[model samples]
Structure formats: C-alpha cells, structure tokens
Target: MKFDSVIMGGGLAGLVAGISLQQAGKSTAIVSMGQNSLHFFSGSFESMTEPPQRVADLFKDAGIGLHYRQGVRLMPLGTFRESAMSLEDIELFPSEKFARRVLIVNFQGYHDFFSSFLAEGLEKKGMRCRIRLINIPDIDPTHQGPGEMRSVQIARTMDRIWEKVVQEIRLLLKDEDAVILPQVFGLQDISVPGRIRQALPAKVVFVGTMPPSVPGVRTQMLLKKRYQLLGGTYLMGDEAIKAHVHEGVVHSVVTRNLDSHYLEASNFILATGGLFSKGLVSNPFQLYEPVFGLDVEFAEDRNTWYNPAFKEDQPYMGYGVKADDTLHAIIDGKPLENLYAIGSILGATHPELGSGAGLAINSALVAVDQILSEK
Candidate 1:
C-alpha cells in the first residue's frame, strides 16, 4: 500500500506525527509491532525538564480530551515515590474537590500493585490515606503465579466482573472521600472512570504500575482511535524489517509478519524508539541504527557507556540516530530529505529524567510542521 507518509513506530511520537499529518490532509499510515511503551504509562507525562505548553492543544487537535495541571505531582508506587511535571485528567472523588481522605484499594491476588506501599507514600506526602482489600472469588482460585498475572489480565478480569467489583467498592468507600485504584480500569473504554464516578460518591483515580501499563494503554488506544477516525491507516502487529532507500531518501519500508509486505510512501518518520525498541543497536565495536543504517553518535570506548553509579544516567541512554535541524536523519553530515527521526530514537535526550514525552511531542510537532512546509 502507498500513502503520503508512513510512520514506522506506534509509540507516542509516531502517533502524534500521524495525527498531525492526517489532520493536515495528508494520507498517513502507522505500521507498528503491536503495542508500544504505553502499557507502562504512569497516568502522567513526565516532561519535567521541558514541559510542552502545547500538550493540551496537541491532544485537543487530535480530538482526544485531557486535563493538564502544571507543577510537579508526586506519583506513588508501593512505598516508592517519584515526581512528574504534569498529570493528565483523572477522576477524583469529592468530584473536583481536593481529596482530604483517600482510600487506596487493592486486589488480594494482584501482585502488580500493593496498596500498603502507596498508602505509606501518600501518607508521607501529608495526605490522609487508608488501605482496603477486595477479594475477587474468581481470581483467587486461578492459581496463577505472580509473574503470570499481568495488569492487562487483571484489568480484563475486573472488567468482566465490574458490577460485582463496583458493589464491593461502594461498600468499602462509605467513609472515604476518594479512591485510588491500580491501573486496571479498562482497556479501550476511556469512559470507565467516568461511569464509575457516576455510580459512586467518591472520585476514582487510576494510577499505573510496573509493566503492562493501564494508563499508557489507554492513551495508546485513544490516539490510535483518533488517528483511524481521521482516515489514517493503522497496521498493528507488524515489524518493519527493511527500508527501501535511494540516494539517502527512504522510498518505502518492508514489514514482516505472517508474510512480507511493502509499504511505499512519499515520506517516512522513524519513531522506532531507542535501545528498548531496538531502533539502535550495539555490536562489539560501536552503536548503529539497525533499520536504515543511520549513523549514531556514541563514545568510542565501550567502557564509557556506563557510569560507576547505577542511579546516574548511563552514557548509552543518550545514544541514538543524529537528526538535522529539520528533524530528518543525517548520514555522514548529509540530510535524508524525506526521512525524519523523532522520539527516543534521537540522540542527547535523557528520558530517565522525565523529559522523554515532552521531547517526543515537541519534535513530532516540529517534524510535522516541516513536512507541511515542504509540501
């Protein structure tokens, strides 16, 4: 199939670019290898260093509504806590009122989250918190190991028995002002929280945990739905195996799944992510971009890739494909006119410091603007 633009990744960057381009009346397609990092989303965009003032507008342009609050908010997981520059909209009890008393709920067999830890952290933050446990009869008898039970699995199970869980929550929330839940609200139903809110007096907030992220999954589904609604083609569960290039411009990308298929486009955006997504790889010698063979900037000595302190950012975290001022990939100081690199695949950004999403969104805006300008 052919389009005006083919986005090579289905993560935040690719989805943003696809939505922007498609909104600009360009025919676009997103070829992805199933779901991306959203499954681990923490219900917040951690753009501490460079908060995007246009975040609300970007989502609004895509027809995805979200609430944003400036300044850092403490995100608690178990007993640990971290900070995010901004938080997306969440349903809170007292229905828009500050939660003076918060009830944290956990499932007995769900190992993905612990209420006690969150309660402790929230208490430390000077919030009044209490812990409540709900035992779902169907889940207890399954005999699944902790590792075998993922957030998605529990979410699906909870969704199937939602009425029963809701009744139980109604009983537990009698005295609570708000309830904090693990991210197992629902997969595609963005209105789940709102529905729950209507049924109860307390506010419901879904916070994500380790892997198989609930909030991240929600954002992914929301963006993909908006993209498709805008007439953008979405090919899920496919991996780009080869790039057909000529004179430094990527003409098309070949994807492999059940069979090989070629996707031709007038322009390409490589949002294929960094080390985690294997967009960039390292051999015994040096780091290199795997798909299009774009040049990567890295320290020559492998010993310099890591620091002695584990908590500190590693050198390899900043290694990615080099991009020019227009956000296109640069090979040996020459720009690949039709090929742009966005998101975690570009070099010198520290995602560990909470600026990853902002960088991705801002760069995507720049890339799409450049594409429209050239057209």
Candidate 2:
C-alpha cells in the first residue's frame, strides 16, 4: 500500500506534519533521530503579543509572511495552541486560571524573560510567585546531560525542595491546601520503541523552564516509544547512506552501517531541519541534503550563512528548501509535484523572525490540508 506521506525528522515540525496528516485520514511515517532542540531551550509557544497588524508588520520586517490569522491572547509560557481560535479566548487556556502560587526555576539563570515577565505580572494580580536559582550552566547542546553539571544530584534534590516551594505558595494563597508548583527538573519514566509491547518509561517530561540534557534525552526516548506504538518506524544512530532517485522522484532510501529499505509513497514531506539538528547534516564529511536526493538551494559560500560572532545569534542559521507560497519545495526553480517542505529546513525567507517552530508546525498543518484537498 502506498503511504499517504513520509516525513523526515521527528521534532515538532515532523511530528506536526505526521500527526496532522494522520488525523486527516492519511497514513504518515516520520523518520528522525529522536532528539530535538526544543528541549534544550525554554518551550514557549508564541503568538504575536501585539495586534495582528502590528504582528504582521513585525514579521514583515523580519521577512516572514503571516499565513494564518494571528493569535490574540498568549498560552502559558511553554505550551503551543493548535490554532488562533483556541488562543483568542483566555478562558480556553488549559492551565489553571489564577493560581495563587508559582515556582520559577532557573538552572542556568537564563529563563525566558518573556515567560518570566508574564509570570511576574500574574503575581501582581495577587498570585504569589517564587523564583529559585538552580545555577546550572547556560543552554548549549555540547554541554548537556546530568554529567555536565552534576544535574543528577540536582534532580534528586528537587523532591524535597518542591515540598518547601509548595508550602510557601500555599501560605501566600492564605490556605494550607495551597500546594507548591515546582519549576525544577523532575524525572518520569516513559515508553520508547522496541520495548513498545510492554509499558516503559522512555520519555522524560521536563518540569522546569530550562531542562537539563538528561530530561531532553528522556523526552526523545519517550517520543521514540510513542511513535513506534503509533506504528511509526525509525532508523536511528545509522545515517542515510544513499537515495535512489530517478527522473526527479525518490525511489528508495539505503542506509550505511545497516541495510537497504524500499519505500513507496504517494506523497512525501521533508522535515529534516538544517545543520544544527542534523536533518541536512547526514555524514562526517558534512554533505547536506534531504536524504531523498532532493535538490537544495543554498548559499554559495557556507561561511556566508552562519553569524561569525559567537555572542550573536546565527544570522545565517536558517537555511533549507526555498518554497513558493504553497509551501512546496522548489527544486531547480520548480516546485516538486507531490512533495512538501516545512519547518526550519525551509531557507532564509523568514530568518530573523524566530517564528520557525510555530510557523513550521502551523504551516505543515496548512500544507496537510492543502495536500488532502488536492486528493
């Protein structure tokens, strides 16, 4: 049977495409290594805090187009609302409304000001807020995991600290029943693939603003488990060795350190992000492609893309497929007939906007609708 779609990369962008397409009555398969940058940073879902017009103008200045309507109100600091309708009404927010006490944990002292500031404003509205400093290093992938900062000990200490934090919050609410909401990293075992037949703790949901690497790894493990349970397959640790494409179409994918696998798909989506996430980075020699032999539009000089100043955010970090208004990958200046590209893998069209995560998921949602509509 031909698959409805095959998405590469399992992060928010890939998962969004997979989940959305599957829900739309399509069989979708997502291929990924299971690690996502979303866990390394604060997981904040952003809607334009400004008005729609102003938001449009702001994104316009940064070169991103507003494909859908802007959201009116904000969700919690770390959650993503599926659509504008859910965000327009504050009453629809899933989190409890007006909790008296809150916990703020900063392992590296660099919690998102956007979320932190909003939490402070909530405190002024008579919510008692407590901020704790975990003193972990700043967020960086290379310096991740419990071993880096002895985060294992830190995670162990949280159970006791959380008790105190909750007690203080209860007092502030003027009731003993008030409980502390922890902002520190906590552990939960999650189920992952291969061991899917039996329930296992594969994913680790991070409870804090900036989760340490251990939690991030655990999160991926959980997703791998869940993805497999949902009938998805993954080729991990092994890199894509070759793509057998003929006449502008992908035929099959072969991986080195492994064996050959044939895939027949009616449609395909490339969610393999850019250099940072290894979507485009497939080998030690550093060749960038979608693993399916897709033609990529890129800078003449690779150095011209990345921001040189270590302190500055990489101005050239956003690079991938150059898509037309339909979000289809444009190869050799032409859109692939049945292929779509979403997420950070899409090129510099929206670089400075920092809207990649939300836009990627939202755009894929839009693309899935468009794809199904065409069928």
Regions of model 1 farther than 4 Å from truth: 48-63, 71-102, 126-129, 138-148, 160-163, 173-178, 198-203, 257-261, 349-354
**Which candidate wins on TM-score?**
1
Question: Per-residue CA lDDT of candidate 1, range 230-296, in tens?
Answer: 9999889888888888888888898886254678888899998888877787888898887788878
How far out, in Å, is residue 345 in model 1? Answer: 0.2
Q: Model 2 compared with the native: what TM-score? A: 0.58
lDDT of 1 at 175: 72
User: Least lDDT summed over 10 consecutive residues: which range in candidate 1?
Assistant: 89-98
